[model samples]
Target chain A: MDKTINQKAWFLVLPVFAVVAFSAILPLMTVVNYSMQDTFGNNQFFWNGVGWFKELLDPSTDLGGRFLASLGRNLLFSAIILAIEVPLGIVVALSMPREGWTVAVCLVILALPLLIPWNVVGTIWQIFGRPDIGLLGYTLNTLGIDYNYVSNEFDAWATVIVMDVWHWTSLVALLCYAGLKSIPDAYYQAAQIDGASRWAVFKAIQLPKMNRVLLIAVLLRFMDSFMIYTEPFVVTGGGPGNSTTFVSIELVKIALGQFDLGKAAALSLVYNLIILIVCWVFYTVMTNAGVERPAKKGGA
Target chain B: MARIDLVDLAHSYGGNAAPPESFALKPVTMTWRQGGAYALLGPSGCGKTTLLNLISGIVTPSRGKILFDGADITPLSTQKRNIAQVFQFPVIYDTMTVGQNLAFPLKNRGVPKAEVDARVKQIADLLDLTPYLGRKATRLTADAKQKISLGRGLVRSDVAAVLFDEPLTVIDPELKWQLRSKLKALHRELDLTMIYVTHDQTEALTFADTVVVMHDGRVVQSGTPAELFDKPAHTFVGYFIGSPGMNIVPAAVSGHEARVDGHTIGLHRNYGVLPAGTKIEIGVRPEFLHVAAPASGLLSAMIERIDDLGRARFARVRVGDEKFSARMPPGFSVPDNMVGLVFDPAHVHVYADSRLVEGVA
Candidate 1:
C-alpha cells in the first residue's frame, strides 16, 4: 500500500539547510571556484583549470615540495601525540577518583588547560620556556641541560609537541573517563568472581567498554592535531629553520603571506580531502575490528 | 562442592538512622548443606543481593565470618574464595566470544589450555550453546547471553559455590521456563551447591531444594518448599511463600481458644496464659479452607466473589468484617452464598507477635 507523504516537512528542514550553506557550503564553493581559476587584482578572472593542482601534485615543484614536507611533519606530529596521549589518557582516566567531591575537583583541574585560549596558552608557554627568567628554563639551564627553544630546532619541536600534549590530552582523558564511568558495577563484580587478575580485568572488561569513546578520542585528536596552527604559531612562530611548520601553517603562509589564493585554495581542499579520507578509513577499520559497545544504555 | 556457613552475618550501609535494625542484612547464622540447591527468596531491597555478594566475596560483610567447607573465607577476595556469580543482568565480556567467556575463569587461574577447551565445550554443550560458542557474546539475545554467563560459572571445576542473582530477570517470558529447567538440570548434573537469589516465589520454589524466605533484611524462615508451604515459622513467611499466601487475620487468644472478631475457633494446642497486650492471629492457606454447606459447618459466610482459574476455582468469602479466600477443587460448582469455609485446625499455623508460637501444630 502507498503511504501518505508530507512534503511540508521540507519547510521544517529549510532553516538548517540555510544555516549550513552560510556556515560551510557557500564558503567551500568559493574555495572550489578559486582552486580552478586565475584572478588578477581588479575583479578579473580566467580559467586556469587544474593548473594549481598540477603544480601542487608535482613534488619537483617548490610548492609541491613544501606541501609534502609539511604534510610529513603534520603526520609525524599526529602519530607522536596519538602514541603518547591515548595510553596516557587511559591511565589517567582509570586512576581518576570514582566518588566524592574529589572527582569534581580533579575534573576542574584537568579541564583548566583546555579552558585557556589558544593564543594565551602560546604566550604563557613562550614566557614559561624563556631561558633567562622562566623557572623551568632557569632550572633546566642550572642543571646544565642547555635548553633554548628560540634557536635550537630540536628544542623548538620538543617544546611545541609538549605544549600540544599539555593543551589537548585532557580531551582524550575526559572522553575515556566518560566511557569508564558508564560501565556498570555488575561487570566488575562478575570479573572479581571470575578470578580475573588486574591486567586481565583491564584487558577484558575496561578496555572493551572504552572502545567507542577511545575511537572518538583518536578521531578528534587526529583531526585537530592535523590542522593545528594557533598555539605553535604563537610560541615558536614556525621558527628555528621551520622545524615546527605543519601543513596548516604552510597553507596559511601560501594563502596570506605570499598572496597565492589559487594554490592555497587547492591546498585547503586537498587538506580537507586527506582529513575526510583518513577519518573514513579510521572509522571503518576501527568499527570493523573493535569491540561492540552496546548502543542502548544499561544491561546486556 | 563446599558447604557455605554464615556466622552472624550483618551488613549495614551506614549513613542510616541507626544500627542492627537499620542494617541492610540483619545478623544471622545459617549453613547451606553441600550439594544442595538453595534460594534466597525475598522482595526487592530485602538484602538478597547483599547476602549473595557477601557469599561470593564481592562485598565484604560489615560483620561476621563466612566459611566455605569449614574454612574461614571471609577475609579472602572473590578470586581466592573460588566462587562464581551470575548477575541479574548478563555480565559478559563484550569483546569475547561465547567460548572465550566460558574459558575465562579457567584461563585466569592458569588452567591448561586443553582442560579449559574441554570444559568450555562441555558447558557449551550442556547449555545448548555449542553452535554459538564461536559467536561474539555481545551479539546474542538476552537469554542466550544469560546462558553464556551461567556457562562461565559451570565451566570451572573447582568453584566453591555458584551464585545466581535473579539470572532470569532479563529473559523473555516464553524462554524463562525453558532456561529455568535447563538450570535445574545443570544443577542436578553437576551438584555444584548453587544458591539462586530471586524475588519470584515460583523461581525460588521450583529451582531450589530449600528456600530461605526473607523479609525486612532478615531470614524469616528456611525450609523445603513443602515445609515452607505447610509450616511457615513467621507470619511474613506464611504471607510471602504461597500463592495468595496464607490468610493472616488479627485475633486474640485465651486458654485453648482463639477469637476472630468475637467468633471463637478451637485451637489445636493449649495457650496456658496470655500477656496483656500480646496480639495473636491464625494463618490458614487458601488451599486448606474447605467450602462446606452452611448448615453442616460451624460458621457461615456470604460469597463476595468467585474466580474461575480453569482447572481450579477460588471464591472470596466474607467472614465477619474481613474477607478470606478458599480454593475449590476442579469441577466444583460454587453456591451463591459460599456460606461455610471450614478452616483446617490441623493446617492452621498460629502466631503470636508475628512469630510462630513454639509447639504450634
Candidate 2:
C-alpha cells in the first residue's frame, strides 16, 4: 500500500505556488537590491555596502535616531487597539440575537464601514475634524473645549486612533462573532448544569473556545495598526512635529519625500521582518494552545 | 434523591388564550418517585424532550409548577435546580482533561479539593474511564468523549435528578448494549432518580423500571414493562411498544362475539353499554396468536410472507382485506394461500374510539 501511488496530484498546486512566487518573491528581490546600493539620477547605481543599515541602527546624527521610539509607539498602538477592539467586538457579538431580522440588520450595519476604502476613511475623518465647520470640531468648540487636531500632537494621535477604531473594530467583532456562533448549545446547557456563574461560563467556555479566532484578530490588527499610514497620513500628514509619525509614515518620508531609496528599502525590510517575527510568535502560541494532549491512566 | 412532581404544566411560545392545537406539549401532571428509574419513550416531536427540558429548568413552564422534594422550583433557573443532564451529543470542555471535566461541577459548587478528587475518581472508575483521566477530552474517540459526558453528570452526587436525552445515540451498536447495562447498574448502585428519554423502545424497556409512553404531547401510559406490554392504554402505545407491534383489526361487536372481516370470533366476556354504532377494534399481540389447521381455527388467512428472525419467524398474512402478523417458532412450516390463526380470548383487547374499553371481555 505504501508503494502504490500516482504523482499527478502535484499538478493541482502548481498555479498557486507560481502566483505567490511572482507576487511575493520578485518584489522582495527588488527591495533587497535597492537596500544594498546607492542610486543617483538617471537610474545610475553604486555599491554602498550596508551603509544604510548602519546609519539606521545608530542613535545620533541620523534620522534613524527616532527608529526605536517609533517602533515603541507602533507596539503601544497595537497593544491598545487589541485591548480595546477584541473585548468590544466580543461584547457586541454577544449582545446580538442568535436569530432574527435584527441580527441580520446589525451584522450588515457593522460590516458597512469595513467595506469602504482605507483612503476614503482618512478623508472622511480629515473633513469631519475641521474646527471651523466640522461637526465634531464645531461641537467641541461650542462646548467650550480647546481642541485643535491640526496643531496639537496629542489631539492628532487621538483622532487617528479613534478613526482607526471606527474603521476596523467591526472586523474583529465579526470574526469573534463567527467563533461564538460555532459553539454548540450543548456547551451552554452543560455549563448551566454545572452551576457555573456568568463570569465562569465566559472564562472557561467562551474564552477558551474563542482562542483561535482571537489569535487571528490580534495578529491582523497588530499588522494593520503597525503599518497604518493612509488615515493618519491624510489627516495629520505625519505633522505636529513628528509626534504621530509611525514607521510607515517615516518610510514614506524617506523614500518619496526625500527620495532616499536605499535607506527606505532597508527600513521597509526591517518593518517586514518585525511583522513576520511577531506574526510567527502569535501563530506558534495559538497553534500550541489548540493542540490536545493524549489521555493517560489514573490521573482523575 | 427527590420526588419530582410536575403539576398541570403547559407551555406556549406565543401569546394566546388557549395554546395552539399544534402546541409541542399539552398540559401534563405526573409524579416520579424518589430513586425510581423512569424513561420517557416516544417518537420524534412527541414532547418527551420538552418535558425533560422543563423539568431541568432549561425551559420554564408557561403554566403550573414543578416541584422537587415538595418545593416549587418551576420558576428557578437551571443552575438553581441542580439537575444534571447528558445531551444527545457529547458536551465537555475540550481544553480540559477528562478528570477536570468530571470535577468541574464539584469545583463550581465550592466542594473541597479532596472531595472533588475523590468524587472524580469514583465516577471515572464506575465509567471505566480511570485509564484516560489525564488525557485531554478533545483527543478522545467519540465513544470515549461520550463517556466523559456521562461521567460529568454522574460525578455530581448532589444533583436532584439525572436527565439523559438519548445519550447513547452516538455510541456504536456493540458499545450501546454495554453502556445501557452499565447505566442500569449505575442506577441500582447509586439509587439516584434518573429519567431517560429515548425513541428506541428496547432501550427504554430494558433500562427503565417505569416506562412513560408518550404520543403527540400526551402521556399515553405509565407502567412497568409487563403492564405496558400486556395492556396498553392507548392504541399508539400498543403499536409503539412491541417488536411486531399489536395487530389492530376493525370489528363489529354483537353480544360476546366480534365480527372481524366477515368472520366471527367469540369473546370470553361481553362489553356492556357500548352503542351499536361505535367504532370498535380488536387488538392482540402476535406472540399470543398461533397458526392452526383451517377448520380448527377462528379465522382463515392467506399467508403473504414469512420473516425468519433466528429464534422465531413471523408470518405476515392477509385476513379478509386487512393484513396481520402471527408469530411462530422456528422450524414451523407455513402453508401457502390457506392459513389458520387462533388467538386466546383472554389476551384480546377491545378499543372504542382510540380509548381502551375497560372491563370488556
Candidate 3:
C-alpha cells in the first residue's frame, strides 16, 4: 500500500486564514501602532515610550482608578453570574422531559432568547427596567420596594445582573441540558439501585457527568461578563456613578467619551491582555480539571 | 435475595381497548424465582424492555402488582425497589476513574472506606477489570466502559435483583459471546437474582435458566430454553426461538391428523373435539424435520436454496404454497428435483387461533 501526504488540503484552510488575518490583524496592528505612540490633532504623532502604560498602572492617577475599579467589577460580575446561572441551568435542564413533543417545545423556548441579538437584549432591558413605565420597576415600586436603577448604584447593579441572567442563562441551560440529555437512562437506574438520595444522584451522577459542559459554561460566562459592555451600557449607563462600569465600559469611556485616543489605545491593549491572561488561566485550569486521565495499566 | 412476581400486569398507553392496538406492552403475569437467571426474549418493540423496566420499578405498572418477596411494590420508586440495571449502551461516569465508578454505589450507601475498597476490588476481579481500575472510564474502549457498567451493577450485593436490558447490544459480536459466558458464571457464583432482556435468541438461550418469550408486550410463554424450543406455546415463539425458526404450515385438522394443501400428516395422539372446520397450523422445528426419499415421507418439497453453515446444512424447500426449512448434517447432498420431509408426529405442535391446542404437548 502506498500512502502519500496530500498537500492540497492546505487549499481548504487558506481562505479561512486569509479572512482572519484581513479582519483581525489589520485593526490589531492599528491598535498596536496607536498604543506605541502619542497622537495629537490631525494624525501628528510623537513617541511616548511606556508613558500611557505606566499611567494606567499607577493608582494615584484617575485612569488607574477607573481601570482597577472596572476590573474588580468585572470579576465580581462574572462570579455572581456563575453562582446564579450554573445551578439554575442544571435544575431547569433536569426538570425537562426526556422525550416527545414536549422536549421539542422546551428546546425551542430555551433557544429563543439566545437567538436575540446582544444589542437588542440591552435595549429590551433598558425599556423593561424603567422605574415609572417599565413593568418590573413599576411592579417592584408598587410593592413599595423603592426600585430605582437611575439613582441607586445597588439597584443598577442588581438590575444589570438580573437582566444578564435572564438573557444569557439560557445558553448555560442549553449546554447543560445537552449534557444531561446525553446521559443514558442507565445511569439513573444505577443511581436508583444504589439507593442514592436525590441529592446524591445530582452530586454523583448528574454533576460529575455535566462537569465538562459546566466548565465550558463557566469559561463562556466569565469571558462574556468580563467584556460585557452593551447591556449594562444601555441599561445603567455605568451609572449612579462608576459602580456598574466594567472594564469594557471604562475602555469605551476612555476612547469615545473622553477622546484621549492614545491612552485609550494603551488601556484597551492592557484590557485585551488582561482578558487574554484570565482566559488563559481559565482555559488551563478548566482543561486540567476536565482532562480525562489516561487508563492505568494495572490497578484496582 | 427475593423472588419477584408480576401479577396481572397490563399496560395501555392510550387507555383504549381497541383491537390491533398501539399499546407497547400487554397484560402479563409471571414470577421470577429467587436467585434465578431469567431472560425476556423478543424482537424490538416486543415489550421485553418494558417488562424489564416494570420489574426494575423504573416505570409504574398501569395495571399490575409487582411483588418482591411477596410484598406489593408496584407503586414504589426504583430506588426503593433496589434493582440495578445495565443498559444496552455503556453508562459509566466518563469523568470518574473506573475504580471510582465501581465504588460510587458503595460510597452512596455510606460504606466504610475499607469495605468500599474491598468490594470494588472484588467486582473488578470478577469482571477482569482490575488492570483498568485506575483509568478514567471515558478513555476506555466501548467494551471497557460497558464492563464498568456491569461491574457497577455487580458491585452492590444488597440489591433485590440486577437487571440487564440488552446490555451487550453495543458490544462487539465476539466480545458479546465472551461477556455472555462471563455473565452466566457471575450469576452462578454470586447467586443474585438476574433478569436479562435481549432480542437475540442465542444470548437468551445460553445465559438464562428460564426464557420468557415475549411478543407485542405479552409473555407468550415462560419456560426453560428447551421447553421454548420444543413446545412453543404461541406461533410467534415457534418462529422466534430457533436459527432457521420453526416451520409452520397452515392446515385443516381432522381426528389425529393435519392435512395441508391436500397432503395429510398423521399424529400419534388425537386433538380431541377440535371444531369441525377449525383453522390449524402444524409446527415443527427445522432440527426435527428430515429430508428423505419422496415416497417414504408425508409430503414432497422442491429444494430452493441450501445454506451451508459449518456444522449443519439448511435446505430451504417449498412444499406446495408453503415454504419450510429442513436442517441436515453437514455435506448432505440434496436431490435435484424433489425432497421429502419426515417429522416425528409426536414432535409436531398443532396451533389453533394462534394458541397451542390444549393437551398437544
Interface RMSD of each: 7.2, 2.3, 3.1
Report the C-alpha lDDT of model 2 over A91-184, residue by residue, as the tens digit: 8877778888988898999999999999999999988998998888888889998778999888887888888889998998898889888999
Task: Compose the digit string of candidate 1's lDDT tens values, residues A102-140.
Answer: 999989989999999999999988888889997877788
Candidate closest to the true structure, highest lDDT? 1
Mind giving the per-residue lDDT tens digits that candidate 1 earns over B1-361?
7888999998888833456788999998999998889999999999999899889988888899998889999999888887888888998998887778888988888999878888888888899998777777888888898998898878887888889999999999889999999989999898798999999999999999999998999999999999999889999888888777788888777666777866677777776566667677788899888676676535677787887777667788788887887886565665467567777777776788898875433
Residue-level lDDT of model 3, residues B1-361, one tens digit each, is: 8888888886655654644356677876778899999998999999888788888877776676889899988888876777888888888765678998898877877889888889899899989998878878777889998999999888888878899999998899999999999999999989899999998899999999999988887789999998998889999999998888899989887668888778889876788667756567889899988777578545888889887777788889898889999876555675575877787787788888778885442
Candidate 1 TM-score on chain B: 0.94
Q: What is the lDDT of residue A220 in candidate 1?
A: 97
Tell me the DockQ of each model, to 2 decimals: 0.45, 0.60, 0.48
Number of colliding residue pairs in each model: 0, 1, 0
Error of 1 at A208 (Å): 1.3
Cα lDDT over the full model 2: 0.86
lDDT of 2 by residue, B1-361 (tens): 6899989887765533654576667888999998999999999999999899999988877777899999999879998897999999998786788898998988889999899999899899999998888878887888999999899888888778999999999999999999999999999888789999999999999999999999988888999999999998888888898989998889887567788877888776787657667678988888887676577546988888887777788888888788888986555675555778898888788888777786544
lDDT of 1 at A167: 92
Which portions of model 1 miss their true places by more than 4 Å?
A3-14, A39-46, A291-300, B15-17, B254-256, B274-276, B329-338
* Winning model by DockQ: 2
